[model samples]
Target: MDANHLINTLFPQGAEIDFDGEFFTGTGQVGDKIVAVLGTQGGVYIGVELAHRMAGIVLDTVRNHPGRPILLLVDTKGQRPSRRDELLGINGYMAHLAKCLDLARRQGHRTIGLVWSQAVSGGFLASSLLADECYALPDAEVRVMNLPAMSRVTKIPLERLEALSLDNPVFAPGVENYRRMGAIRDFWQGDLAACLATALDSPTGPDRRRAHGLEREGRLMAYKVAERVRHDPV
Candidate 1:
């Protein structure tokens, strides 16, 4: 969906959003509530500067907006893969951005992520995946890595990965696959304003993605394994 159309749909009361082609940050009204909005656009590659800038917005929202809910609009390719970024510690910057969002959640600001377009790899991880509840638009694309790339990284062979993806949503790349894995809480469709309102009014709770994964049968053992680890007498 076009960014402007999405903003208008979600914030029918109008918003004060600003988009500079790649990055956008602003505030929008959802009913009687105001939400802090921050996100990337056009499948931009997230680098040190972009990560730092996003983190600053989250931190500022926490400090200035008190308990206002935050909305993350994710659409990125991944971290910028370059020697300079590596030398500058791109991982640290991404982690900082994730931590800033975590801080906002802890500080009583409801954090919601909407995957309106593409969300891949570390870019998805540090943004949408960190939200209290992450939802995807009907046509959103979400993937950690493509099969050929995963094959190269894991040496699992493209054929084997392809066969695995048939039954295991974990090996697949799509909004449905992600929804099955519980990475995406749900899909937002129909009246978008209503969807946003409903999401905002939803109760906050502990992360349930693992449990959802089990129920959906996409990751049968993840929740059980996590439970075992949590109860381990180490």
Candidate 2:
């Protein structure tokens, strides 16, 4: 969904969100709780500058308003392919951004991620997947490297991986498949404001996603492996 439609759905009373043609940043109320809103559009490839800006946004919100919810709207194609960025340690900048969001979580600010469009590669990893509670719209496209790229990297036949991905939710590319893999916890619908409000109130810290994935038969071995690790102490 476009930002305007999304804003209308979520903030009927008009959220104080400012949208440039490129990206959006602002704060608004979800139910009775005020939240920090950060989003991107047009499938922009996020670079180091954008990543650091996102970090700043979270850091400012956490410093000024502790315990407030932070909402992330992830719509990025991937990381910007720049040789200079690699030289300048873009990886470190992304890590810093992740640290900022983690700091928000540590400070008791609930973080939520909503994906209605592209959620791919380093862009998604630096933000959306880091949320305390993650969800996706039905139309959201969520995936890592596409099958062809995976084949190229692993030197496996694309046809083989494609067939496997059809049966294995973890290998597939869809919102429901991510939910199945326990990455995205739920699907979102109904009243947007009320839904966000409920999400804020019901912060599932240390949730049962790994177990849910196994129960749903999507990520079969993850929970068992974790349990095994837990039981067999060093």
What is the C-alpha lDDT profile of model 2 across 1-234, one tens digit per residue? 787788778877668888876588898866566788999998888898889888999999998999888999868988888998898899999899899999999899899999878899899989988889788887888988788888999999999998888777877678888888788878888777777777788846686778888877788998999999989978
| Ten-residue stretch with the least lDDT total in model 1 | 164-173
Segments in model 1 whose C-alpha atoms lie over 4 Å from true places: 152-160
- Candidate 1 lDDT over 2-59, as tens digits, reads 7888898989998999887789999999888999999877899999999999999999
Candidate 2 lowest-lDDT run of ten: 200-209
Judged by TM-score, which candidate is best? 1
* Pairs that clash in candidate 1: none
| Count of clashes, each model | 0, 0
User: What lDDT would candidate 1 get against the real structure?
Assistant: 0.91
| Leading candidate by lDDT | 1
